[model samples]
Target: MADPLPTSLPQDTAPPPPGIGQLFLGFLSVAVVAFGGVLPIARRALVERHRWLTPDEFTELVGLAQFLPGPNIVNLSVIVGARFRGIPGALAAFLGLTAVPAVGVVLAGMVFSRYGDVTAVADMLAGLAAAAAGLVLAMAARMAEPLWRRPQAHAILIALLAFVGIVATPVSLPVLMLTLGPVSILLAWWAQRGRP
Candidate 1:
């Protein structure tokens, strides 16, 4: 297993409030630090370093995000942004997180066809491929750990089923939500009613 994370996150850090600058910088920092794996750092920066949300609250938001249809990062940006500022906050976060990376990728892709065949470039990319795999695994575990504890069995089950359903066909995102969201909500309601 990987070594334990830092015992105490840096003490000098400060909480973030609603400001376009802080919101933008917070996500930009996460995006930059997120090289091999961004989710872990992103979570720490937003929930821990910034103390924008309690760890549990962050986990709940992240959980809702994963089941949503877009890229996980975009989903996260929406939730975190909305929490901190509002819909505009969400947009700022999304732009901050996505814009630079998108442009960088476009530039890289443009160059890749020309440079891709070079042995050194190919070797570098090969390593990145492996690292990217690891990053995704880390992201999966980060997402899964919380749900296991809270034991949202039905949501988990529905997510699993929705995953399978998506895999089984080429359904669009809206349709997939149409298929899964209500069912999950109904199940959640039933589960809540059964409790207490």
Candidate 2:
């Protein structure tokens, strides 16, 4: 019998790409909802709600974003926008993603500077930090879900090695990437080479 899993990540038939307005609003909504971290919310918005990208696509874009300079989410926003609607779309998504958050940060900074010494204010900030940590953990699990579903064991093995290398061993990120990154690309290419 043929292998059940596709040689590459499965691509669903996606809806037409979003217009500039939609891109703006989609990212705006993500910005408004996700306070400290946006990955979980962005994933939900793009994959689950909008169906703009499949889970695997989201993971791929995020991985690329991580390798680029600047904030991962910022890079993701720009990449998605550019992929869909070119330069204008990139501007729209970038503006939508940052505008409100930038204003909020400035206002928050001012407020915190004033009330930072208060016990209640400090406690609230502490609570937000804890919540952010939880969100990060949740997002990490969601990101790994695609890898778990893929049939090829090599993907999982590579992910495990990278995790162990980073967390348990003393290998630096650049060193680890230099070692495993090429292997990953080659494996992915080889896996799909038979596809028409």
Candidate 3:
């Protein structure tokens, strides 16, 4: 008889390590063109272009990044870079990701400090902020697709609870993290226990 399909999802195979030069140039490209946010571009490069991480892996990495203290993309760069090439990889990714943006921000700051008070400049800045927010929201929706495909309902519930816990309620982030983090893990584990 043919063997039955496994109940649990198969673990993704790790791909070959990208060289430090590729890491630097990939992040440099992401940094240069990413206007509203870097996460989307980073995802495209790491998961889609290079095939370094699968979609599910990318989502998990992003989740871990969100829980950490640093900026999400920065933390992601460090984790992904280190995963592929250790500390030197981490440094290369971090520097490549931030270097150009840092310079741009400094120059923008200099100009804004001079012209920011103007009504036209203020309006333009407001528009940019709105556009950035939209980009982030769109990226979030795209990332949520993997979770939406899971068989368990609690996966979606946990996500909704997290959203409401942070946005609708007055509860602090640290408290929510402490409370929800374990609960989510336990639920996932419980759901997976029935699988072969």
Candidate 4:
């Protein structure tokens, strides 16, 4: 007999979401092409190429990293690493993603600092900033698609609350996770607990 509910099992798990090699290679590729726009590409690479993190997992990782110290990319690598292979994976991702980029930045900053005040550099920075903003907007739309489809009012309300909470103050994401995330889940759990 066929299972009543359909499930989407992952296709590959041999090397894990991010294999050891992908740790370096994936970040390196994103870094080179990312330029002023990386969020979408990074999402695709992780969710599609390496399968390091699912779309939902990727968003949580991005949000978690945004609140932590260091660069967003560095934080992202750590989260991806942790998810992919536990502590060792996190370590591998951190070293792989940040090492080369850090070295390159040091070298480039040395050269670029001398010409940092150049008009060309300013224009490039401006362009890149615009690109980053667009990338972020796209990510928002992509993330909200499924949420809009879900037929749960409480879930939607929780999301709206999260959105408002995030914008209303300098609230730490950890706090929001602690307060709202679980409460929302618990509310649903409680609501259904008495259902036959």
lDDT of each model, Cα atoms only? 0.79, 0.90, 0.88, 0.74
lDDT of 4: 0.74
Q: Which ten residues in a row have the lowest lDDT in candidate 2?
A: 5-14
| lDDT of predicted model 3 | 0.88
Estimate the TM-score for candidate 1.
Answer: 0.74
Better of 2 and 4 by TM-score: 2
What residue runs in model 1 are displaced by over 4 Å at the alpha carbon? 1-16, 66-69, 159-177
For model 4, where is the 10-residue window of minimal lDDT?
8-17
Best-fitting candidate, scored by lDDT:
2
TM-score, prediction 2: 0.85
lDDT of 4 at 90: 81
Cα-based lDDT at residue 147, candidate 3: 76
The segments of candidate 3 whose C-alpha lies over 4 angstroms from its true place after superposition are 1-15
Each model's Cα RMSD: 7.3, 7.6, 6.7, 6.0
TM-score of each: 0.74, 0.85, 0.89, 0.70
Instruction: State residue 191's C-alpha deviation in candidate 1, in Å.
Output: 1.0
Q: Comparing 1 and 3 by lDDT, which wins?
A: 3
User: What does the lDDT come to for candidate 1?
Assistant: 0.79
